[model samples]
Target: MAHPTTSVLCTELGFEWPDGTTVLDGFHLAVGPGRTGLIGLNGSGKSTLLRLMAGELTPTSGTVRIGGELGYLPQGVTFDTARQVDEALGIRAAREALHAIEAGDTDERHFTAVGDDWDVEERARAVLDRLGLERLGLDRTTGELSGGEAVLLHLAALLLRRPDVLLLDEPTNNLDRRARSLLYEAVASWPGVLVVVSHDRELLQHVDQIADLRDGAVTWYGGNFAEYERTVAAQQETAERLVRAAEGDVQRQKRDLAEARVKLDRSASYGKKRAVTRNDPKVFSGKLKRQAQETAGRVRGMHTERLTEAKERLTAAEDAVRDDAEIRIDLPRTAVPAGRTVLHLDHVRLPYGPRADLELRGAERVALVGRNGSGKTTLLRAVAGELTPVEGEISTPVPLRYLPQRLDLLDDTLSVVGNVKRYAPAVGDNAVRARLARFQFRGGRADQLAGTLSGGERFRAALAALLLADPPPQLLMLDEPTNNLDLASVRQLTQALAGYQGALIVASHDLPFLRGLGITRWLELDGTLREVDPM
Candidate 1:
């Protein structure tokens, strides 16, 4: 079914939190039918804009107009564990009504409840199957599903409604490769106004347009994520060139201004000497002094005005060149010597999933891949000593650190620096703050409570705490490390990891993120653990 060329419009939209924190001020955007990728740094209100468009939130001022029915999926979706798959699909009542009608119920209410959805259950099943949820029947409870499966289920529910305007927020954040491919197919074929907020580059490849939200404004581009990158790169290069030119002009103006001042000073000195040498009329002497002062003032004002204008131009040019910088820090003590065994798992059996025997050598990067519920996280926790193995003998030759998916490694009551300092009790406040600065939490930001920070900031804080711990981890274990990171934060993580010379084992579904780390080993966990080719 093809939808109308309906569009979503925001008429000078303005939004703010309850506590008077402004997010968007006089923002305006229009999204037409077909895929539009919404991208921005974390805390830049991309999610908020989607919420507003879906009517999940009302703008503080201005208007949001959608031309058709809408469906929305949030970044973190929550479902009741007791709810069955049918309930989660939002068709339990309708299904029950249809069954009653077939059982010869003469009540008009049952027919009313069933409405036009006579084949609702079949349609639900088909959509579920399309989204790779056929393995789990509709009678199964929500708790029986994995995180990625649940996300797909949410999307499936939205699709079942056949909304004309679909809004998905971070839809591919935790999906595996296959799940992402399915989602991409759905997005590519969607006929309605589809706006997706995501940092997943591959997913963004299916978009027809890219809308970038930054500093409370939207900039539209005419193509997919790759085209947006190329266009932005070209613009940035031009902006940087203009910045350099403006800087040179400013410097030249300053030099000219200084020369003008010198000439004015020399002229004043000469005028004074001439007046002393010539015993002319007092009026003539006064006129000559006035003229000299006027001429000097004119020259000084002209140069000063030119210099100010040049400086302003330089400032504007610099502003056009985005100043977003990635995190760069060194952790040399984390280096491990070649051939040193950093970890050894002798016939380890997971409590719920796989069994394996493994030996991890110095500075080896490993990618742990599998479907959801395959126990990648359990294996990591066991290796980190956070969980007791059902049957295993594990040895760690060096200090280790574990970063879980939830990133609950920090105390919410404490500040970021406090969290790092707690992990490294021997480290002083100054040292901790210095390290936090490298993580991009400079000055007062280091003192913000962990509970108050945004998703990206909290992840950086968690990473900083883990890496800055005492003795320095030579073995770092991360579970779904890139789960909710925006593109900038992901790049920051990559930059920071590039400097850490440690053995890393990261369980993540993001193939690009894994490849970015330059994985030397690939291990897939099922009921059995086995090594797979990295390629």
Candidate 2:
């Protein structure tokens, strides 16, 4: 039996995909009441662990125990569009039962169904209001709500359950500034055990501690994301210093071994000369020679052992240092000269978003931010020519490319190399592969199918295709590009964008990423597009 206070406990937990890919082996985790930020790289099994904890998946080998009722909000909050918001909130039955009794049905079943949840509807409504979804009435169909609204609705349903344990995966992926703020408030006040797997720094700021899932294990860090960063930075600095010291030790060992060998050879030569000059008897001379040979062999063995130990230490030291690869590519063709007209929007009105006029010239980098359901994605689609504007003139003097939030640019059947080739048909296979290597899709990785890729790998492939397109995008637009990406991958993306010389527009809620882009302009979409201070 698990401890009474332990909200969740997994003992000797292990899981493997049907295809024989092992995710976790002998993994043991115990989480108590409080918010824990579960962080890791995209393919590091954070979602898998959450699924196991939520009972959505059965482990191949061990047991999971929960001390209380559990609620889970998946990364993708999917439901039938025809379902009512009340049904989606898991309160339809109780609400119906209460209404029937109010209407004098006089059925014992209604009373039984209502139980102690007579105020279920009110509680649900309050949760919705807290999550900024009060406008979304219970009578509304799920289809009427946007993606962000669906996510919040799912969270509201979970909150209504009021479980002792709550697990949320990428909860803030599609949320905008205001929605995220609302979520932050909810997380702050969560009394039960909460484990959230996310890359959103703001959301992570509310965590009581960070559980970094790396290399199939959990390493706990006290405090929130900022403190975790500081701790890891300090650790890396120490690891690097150890690596340097170990390297020096290895070099010294090598030199000492070489010198020992030279001295042994010289000593043997001198012994041979001395024996020949002394003209000792054959038996005595041969015995002395054998002894000298044995001594030399022992000396050589000792030096070799010392060298091997030094090399082993060096290897361990190097392993301690993080070698996360970065994307570094030079695209001279993507550059847009100063005063060049990249994009122009003449009184453009988005379908459900904003009505605005804008002109982007030269290599200006723009950050587009807004509240959820404010139509940031809609405006990007309109600019990308995916959607017809309500009424306006939009012109692009140079070639452009848009990376949507869904990342549907690549054909699932094609490999990463093939996808890039499809975009840049004129480029040779070898040339494409060479460029993709810079994006960390090296060798066999470049040959993997797009459908088989993890979220981060797929993002990288899509980004590579867009940037390496035939004409090279002079006006590049991205919608929530950092979603599903790990912190390291986010840094890699930031580095890649740093090398871009074209006019760039990114619609994202990631303040740190936007700030890192050296954004020359900041625009907010409400009812209209307006300039905001560079944040």
Candidate 3:
């Protein structure tokens, strides 16, 4: 059971843009203890609402109340290039406090300020161990750590603060399978209030409740993402039925108004004829005209009311069930000769800077599965011709598209359109625009700077460029293509790949994703690459 004190409440909150356009209105959310997942499509005010909860943004008209201390881990953290993990963990502060105590300078002021008298090194080591960084060198520069490692370190630091309420935004974005599992385990065991925003279906399944943000309001559900999805489907069906019924009512009302208008017209013509006859004709005509006018007014009022109600019903139905179009890649057609081996490695081995062979592989849809720094990415790069082989003959087709795990191919300085045009000139502007639209970029967004785009947007941009290239490659190599992608986008990519007729070598720990794609074979990269049967 959750404690009553550990709760978050929002009341009739609203937000508007600088142009007086509403982004979120009449919003209310109640988050109780236990893990709650926040979900929505991009630009649906999920982030804005999170900021409001964290007290980083003020609501325009309503109040947000958090019952306890709040701690937040933003979507991504900025690491100090010069600092190491130990430095980031406040080892210096710990050391200073320790030294003061050891020097027999334990004044009340110093002791109160320091808070502890334990060895700083031991404390730091303990914290690092809990975060799975015990073996990592304290002196290692932060700049040298991989993106995934950096994220873990930042998370460890945040946990050290021991906040009562933890707000995490896409915490699993760059994490590998092992790291993600560790994070899930930690959150599950935590006793504080947790509000997380993520699109990973697997991660979301662990949450206690799902708060779906759509059309500027939050809908609460009692189960995981799958349950929420089912609920949404049912609600959408009901809304569609209501909308259709409303339309029928509107049509019926229109017909009734038309009939009434016809009756009034007939009555007027009858009165006009009597007025043309003689004696007391004016009085009779006036009475007939007054009755006609009254009928007309009633008919008009009823018609207006019916139309307004119908329109409102339709709008409500549309709002209840917004369409999320899965992103589909329009891969350029290419001629890949059948039975022509696209990639072959004969007794190939991966060496770590003059060390013995670390991993070996053969031709297959080999999933390099391991923890971070397990050399999965290195193997992919070696196959892609980016890294030279140390001891074997590696052969691949001339044009292979390699999507790195971290989308490093994008030029940060270039605009989205510029990058596409430069890398894939054969794709004309119109075609490029169409492809971008499939990925949900439209209007001026297609022209925005790539550096300014969000993680999801950047992934879409990279995929767009890959598909637009002239002479599409026969072999598609991807390292964790599902990372940071929303569920809908992942489905889109999976569907596109399902229809693709090419060799694919992907390294991802997303077991469900790999199975969903129906990968033909598996290559396990542990010490030596060996073919393993898929589970």
Q: What is the lDDT of residue 109 in candidate 3?
A: 63
Instruction: Give me the displacement of residue 151 in model 3, in angstroms.
Output: 2.8
**In candidate 2, where is summed lDDT lowest over 10 consecutive residues?**
15-24
lDDT against true structure, model 2: 0.90
Winner on TM-score between 1 and 3 is 1
Q: Summarize candidate 1's per-residue lDDT along 1-535 as a digit string, tens digits.
A: 1223547888889998764668899998877778999988877888878889888889999998888788998877768999999999999899889989999996899999899999998999999888888887888899867678889999999999889889999887667778888989889999887999888999899999999889999899988999999999999999999999999999999999999888889888988888889876889989999998998888888999999999999999999998677899989999999899999999899887589799999899999998877888789889988888889898998999999878888899999999998889999999999999999889988998787676778899999999999989999999888877889889999999999999999999888788999899999998878899885
lDDT ranking of the models: 2, 1, 3
TM-score for all predictions? 0.94, 0.95, 0.77
lDDT of 2 by residue, 1-535 (tens): 8887788898999998765668899999999989999998877788889999988999999999988899998875777999999999988888888889999998999999889987888888889999999898888899877678889999999999889999999898888778899999999999999999988888999999999888888999999999999999999999999999999988998898899989989999998998899999899989988998999999889989989999899899888887778988888899999999999999998787479899999999999998877888888888888899998989999999999878889899999999999999999999999999999999988998887677788899999999999999999999999888888899999989887889999999889899999999999988999999978
Q: In candidate 1, list every pair of residues with a backbone clash.
A: none
The Cα local distance difference test for each model comes to 0.88, 0.90, 0.73
For residues 145-184, write the lDDT of model 3, one tens digit per residue. 6567777787777677667888888787667777888788
Worst 10 residues of 1 by lDDT: 1-10
Using TM-score as the measure, what is the rank order of every candidate, best first? 2, 1, 3
- Stretches of candidate 2 off by over 4 Å are none
- Model 1's alpha-carbon lDDT is 0.88
